[model samples]
Target: MSVAATRRLNLVTEPILPRIRPAIAALAPYKQGKQAGPDAFKLSSNENPFEPLPSVLEALQRTAPINRYPDATASRLRARLGVRYGVNVEQVHVASGSVSILQQLILATAAAGDEVIYAWRSFEAYPSLPLVAGATGVQVPLTADARHDLNAMADAVTDNTRAIILCTPNNPTGPIITSAEFTAFVERVPADVLVILDEAYAEFVTVPDAVDGLAERVYEKHPNVVVLRTFSKAYGLAGLRVGYAIGHEKVLDSARTTGIPLSVTSAAENAGIASLDAEAELLERVAVIVERRTRLLEGLRAAGWDVPDSQANFVWLPTGERTDEIAAAFVANDLVVRPFSGDGIRISVGEEASIDRVISVATSVR
Candidate 1:
């Protein structure tokens, strides 16, 4: 064959893969909080500073049957959560983490040509969750005070919108949606749309009027609402990866269809059960973190930093244009914080000793 003919044959023989979805190709992988070095504290992930209770550890140790797959439905844990939340077992859906449940809910409700609305600068994972499910993300800007502008978010809703995520004590920003505001917003949203209330940091909240998500049986009244919670924060089970959602049985049934079967291991389930069993002890630790957060906020404000009133375990430093520079200064001082360049920094309340260093760095930057 001629040279051109041979080249054509080679081209035909070469393997050519189908094009990847442009949305997936353009997506950035989730960036985890940076880890700290040997002498430094890792205040980036907003992890609970306290260790697991002895009962939790004991339950983890007692987990058996490594050779067998875990319960696909996490029945016992779900039942316990149902009892605690005053919902039926069918209303509880447990997953690897609240994030996983969020993803499942997105997949269950949204797809290409659909829109999932959420506040900008809320959870880092919120934007990406819809993308993975081939849904468009519509982000509403937060208020000047770093709180969700629920009214604006409601206004942004269109016929194509399928889901709305409301993250209370919103991650990185640390402001909770008030009960009255949330109820009013819920009323405005179309009943056909799914509203996910992410309460990952619920246990740390000291605000009396903050939307409880479950305390008022809002979910009971609104079949479209779902509340997501995690053991990772208050219960110190970040390593185990267990979270749950309370919603209408039909809605949870849809999410359950999207979940990865048996992804929640026996150990995680047992630990979660044990954590609930030791709730009082775990909450005492939450009290300590809350106290630290209060002091941290006071220090930041006194140092001339206009920080938001944080109901979560972390505080947001609105460094704006100086975000990168301020974050670097903290890193240099062995403090690892999550920085959204051109926006601000999120410093998790960590070890008691780490607070002094965090305050010093904030003071210097100011």
Candidate 2:
């Protein structure tokens, strides 16, 4: 086309483009977990280092035709989870991952003027989901020790608040909210505001007083409560990408209505079933992780790294401004750990061998 024709076309298009939704333009894309090299020790993303249980492996080997579509309702897996959790099948919904369910939950319940409440520096996805849903994000700052301040979180709730997400044994930080505190918080929260109890790391936590708020008790009494769990962590099925939400039928129905893609793959469903069946075996691996987490913390403390008492499968090194130096040193030693802020590096507790290598690198860096 001639220069004048092209100029006129551009002028017309520019005005039309400005009419696009402001929310879409202002939104930030979700940043995914860090990647690790083949030869490096990857402690990013808080994944279980354990191989899939033999049963899960066998199930995958027996994989059916991938050419066919998956069960949109995911009936068999839902049935098994219902029986396991003692909830009606209608109360449970499965998704490719807990993150997908979280996104669906946000979209279903919140609108442009509504709000989604969560802790800062918690799950990286927490803030992004609200922006995508065109909802305001109320991020309460973490307490000095890096735990969620439930009181402040509850106080932040306003008439516009539609949902609150709580990540127990919080990622990056590792402190868990007690049952009593959560119970009190819930009682104060408005009945209509949905509280999402994200228990993705629950299976790894072994505290006697540790709040397993996602247990059947909460769901039974609180119609507004929803618990999210995943096979990605303790079940060691991260590659399979299966997670589920347990809540009242009404709440689940709203989330399901958002239309999760039907083809979640039959392989993921089979893997989940196999993992659930191998619970005892998976727990054994979890025990090892717990032990490693303890030893790793003790080691870091002895080396004067000021580590927190982490219940998750990873330990955080709060080095403040030295975070970059520390993380760079690990990379120099051919190790990979997730770094956050200028002071924190989350190192996953892997196999005994990998743990030793990480410890050595940390010691050298220090």
Candidate 3:
């Protein structure tokens, strides 16, 4: 942060962004935790604590020639997913992660001067995707308790609004919008404007009122609706990077066309199919995560810290200005928790030992 340090950092001689697309230049690089090293206990990216199931590992081992091109259509994975979800194969499109799929959707639908709406504290990808697609972003403030103010978001719609991203059990704050709320909001949104329900953490949520009927809601009722999901979280396959989106065939077609790399890698495709087959095993891991999340919430609260009722695999520390201090303390203890603007620290629920480290560090904070 010193001028001398800044000067040292400025040694690169490319005019910072020389000749890059203006849109690309405008993006500050995405920050993730430091990769493996002696001091790394990364609980930053909200990955599941469990390793890939035995079936998934076996599938990977049995996979044939890596040099050969993958199935362009990802036919086997698509067929399995479609059958499992009771939807037509055309309705589902797979990508590296939900992030890629999201980018493709924005590129397909948004253009210069158009507006894309999402909650202020929702997925970090929401803002970047719209901007990268050459559209303006409309960030609505969260409600009093850190939940999406769906009514206000609906009111933000304008003639130029092309899409709205609703991140359920919202990242860093795990509150889900009710089905009634979504229904009401959907009714108000224009038919031409796409409404994306990002359910990356869907498996972690246990609320009765929470909406998990994303496939049905999007594919059956609303032509403009798109649902994004991932195998990274509950399925324990973040490294494999397989995610999917379900929408009307036409909307899915647009994403397929715009998405890079043609399809998810064959390894990821095979892993996804194997993951589906291990649903029971994955659900058991999910149950453990839910239990651990409960313990984390209760422990944090009992230690006199204010925390939200989380339905996701992570807990939010909404202490605003204290975030830096907390994150520093965590780092000192060899744990890495994500810090956001104001006083937010998102700590992923990991194994008991990792959770204990977080609790210990948090409790030691003055």
Candidate 4:
């Protein structure tokens, strides 16, 4: 075509592209654990294997009209959570999941040029959340035992640090930060800086001294601290997507402000409340997971694997250079496990048969 004709065609067809912020543009989105094939045990995501409680299904059946928007505050669920945790209703804030609350709190407190600190290799999402908020992420490396080095994390805090996330019974690794350790560490952090205890797996803890965020030593003494908990794990509500935070109303207010409106759906809210009502039976399930976790820990150790002692529903195998190879063996044996490249393998406590399969596969791989 002639230059004039080509120019006219370009003008008609060309469209301006929208610019994504460089921080987000370069950021990698969070990846959910890979789904497994039929007949395989899915030990990738730390999901509860049990079916939903009858009450939860009943409440879901009576969910508010889909045409109407959800309650902005999710008041009933939050109020129920408040009573269960011994906090006032305002102190409880509900979100689609604790991760959503994590994003909101970071947005509320940090921005470009500010910093948010968390342990490296804790939650996979932690590294990306700050970058999404246009804030810097400071990742303090965990100690040799696959546990957070409280001293290192405390020392890394700076004047520009706006928030710190502590994932107790830290995801993947499964070692708990003791109550005494947390108390001492929080004392060193600036009072105005936000400290988020991401306790998404709190219900599975069997350790006697694991830090309880709602207990007096954690939240009550520290005004800036907020605790995040989720129903997705122990309560078998992962599909429903409900989680909450408990803290000083003012601090939680910041997260509420930054949160996406009506993100917590009516069905999720009802499920959360119903789950609370069924807490006793749910904790029994948690007890079973803890028992299985103990068995898995002992079995792996007895087989000469140097895995960490976990208080969560998962165990960590420090396969290190052998991570991928061992994870592949498990997959071949119909066990889908989460593998962090060149790091470690996280095996969620799944069915009883899967436990035996895990030990057999790890032994074979070893």
Candidate 5:
């Protein structure tokens, strides 16, 4: 970028707004995935293609009056999740969504001068969350194949490190961190530092050996560890905003202390419980998306794109410097995509009809 037209993501050259922290002023608010035109498929956000489950709707309809405050503790939902994860109710924490919980955890553990580590080009939220806590973010670059570099991440740890976030079946890239890889990486981390396993898309992952934070009970062995899960993706509850965490009781208590009170509504809590009751049907829907993802991955590779083998409901296209150009083509063809300039495009596995158009656009560009 030319100096005259230069805009830095964090470089501060101008006067700060009155009463604003320089750190906060240097950053911009997060931008959501681009919205598509009415006739176009919104393939930018990795949302579930299936409609909301009947159970969730029924639960919402039966919700109590809105005048009264919701159960701030989300007691019933926490109990249900606790039983599902084979842990005590104290081990489960519910919030608006996993991202809210992530922010809460960052606030609880990190502060000025502390360092928080995560793999870059993984999750868009990871880099920005630490900034909110006044902590410096240490971005470890992903491997050439678009997976986390766990070894390098472990080496990046220092005495000032306060927390580390691991996104399995990572967003955009869609590659999972294996169980073996997580275990070895945790061994290198200090016991006092926090390790957050953000498994927001765990329901979509198909690999047998991928990291299972709750099933394996990594927290039982590593008390500093916390696993985050969300209903937004698989349960079609993105609009409802419900997510939960499973781990050590004390660690969750700390997160709760830092959370915004009454953020999880009664409607959201009821829907989460109903979704859990209807998990079998939801898994069936997930199976369909998994097949769609497989088809999309195969077609992209057949079109000569260097796409990653995604276990989640999305695929990555390494369009390099042509990212903007290729993404524009997809948009022109009515398939909105998320593009990171100079890096790649992440197209969500959307409606069945969007599959061919995505591939067709890439083929034409190539």
Candidate 6:
């Protein structure tokens, strides 16, 4: 075509392009942990180093009819979870992962002009979820010790606040909200506002007073409360992608309405069921991880680094301004760790063998 004709055509086509939401267009995409090389210890993502239980693997192998769509409601898994948690099947909701459920819950309750509150530097996804739902994110800063400042979070809530996410054993920083603190905080929150207790790392918690959302049954009293759990970390089913939420039937139904259809696959459901059947063995593996975490914490302390008390299967190093430099050092030693520049580094308690190298690298960096 001639230059004039081509210019006219370009102008017409450009104006026809779909308009993207300014909020979404400005938002950064989610960043996954860096993949490690063959010889490296990938302690970036907080993953269970143990392989899937034999029973779970066998169940996955038995899962057939992949051509068919999965159970959109995940009824069987929900029923099993209901039995375990002492709730009705209607009160249980399953999704591809707890993160997906979180997004669904956010979308269910919050939208433009509403607010969703969470601790800053807790979970990377927390802030993004609300934004995707067209809600404003209100990040309450953590205490100096890296624990959630629940009181501050309570104070930040307004009439516009639609949801609040409490990440127990707050991710990356690694300190759990105690039972007493949680109870008091919940009391302060408005009854109508949704509260999500994200217990993704609950299985690894060894602290005696740490809040157990299911045991507490806060949902029974506060119908707006929801407890989120996952098989990815403890049950070693990250690849399968299964997670659940226990809450009041009505609250869960709202989240269900927002969820993507048939996102949770049959294979994931089967793996979750098999994991439940072999809970004893899987928890025994968690016990090992807890022990390793304890040892790693002690070693870091001995090496002269002031690390926070970590109940989760990871430790946080408050590298501050030197976060990038320290993370680079870890990478040079084949230790792939998650680093938040100008903030800190989160190193997962991975393979037992990786512990020694972690200590060595940490010591050298210090």
Candidate 3 TM-score to native: 0.93
RMSD of each: 2.7, 2.8, 5.0, 2.2, 6.2, 2.0
Off by over 4 Å in 3: 1-18, 36-40
Candidate with more favorable, higher TM-score: 1 or 6: 6
Residue 30 of model 3: what lDDT?
79
Superior candidate under TM-score, 1 versus 2 = 1
Clashing pairs in 5: none
Candidate 6 Cα errors over 4 Å, as ranges: 1-16
RMSD of 3: 5.0
| Model 6 error, position 259 (Å) | 0.4
> Which 10 consecutive residues of model 4 have the lowest summed lDDT?
212-221
Compared with the true structure, model 4 gives a TM-score of: 0.95
Q: Which residue pairs does candidate 2 place in steric collision?
A: 320-343
Clashes of each: 0, 1, 2, 0, 0, 0
Instruction: Please give, for residues 82-138, the per-residue lDDT of candidate 3 as tens digits.
Output: 898888999888888888888889999899999999997877777788888888999
Residue 151, model 5: lDDT of: 97
Angstrom error at residue 183, model 1: 0.8
Question: Candidate 5: which stretches are off by over 4 Å?
Answer: 1-17
* Candidate 2, residue 347: lDDT: 84
> Quick one: best TM-score, which candidate?
6
* Each prediction's whole-model lDDT (CA): 0.94, 0.85, 0.85, 0.90, 0.91, 0.93
lDDT, residue 113, candidate 3: 92
Model 3 has an lDDT value of 0.85
Ten consecutive residues with minimal summed lDDT in candidate 3?
32-41
Q: Could you tell me how far off, in angstroms, the CA of residue 161 lies in candidate 6 after the best superposition?
A: 0.7
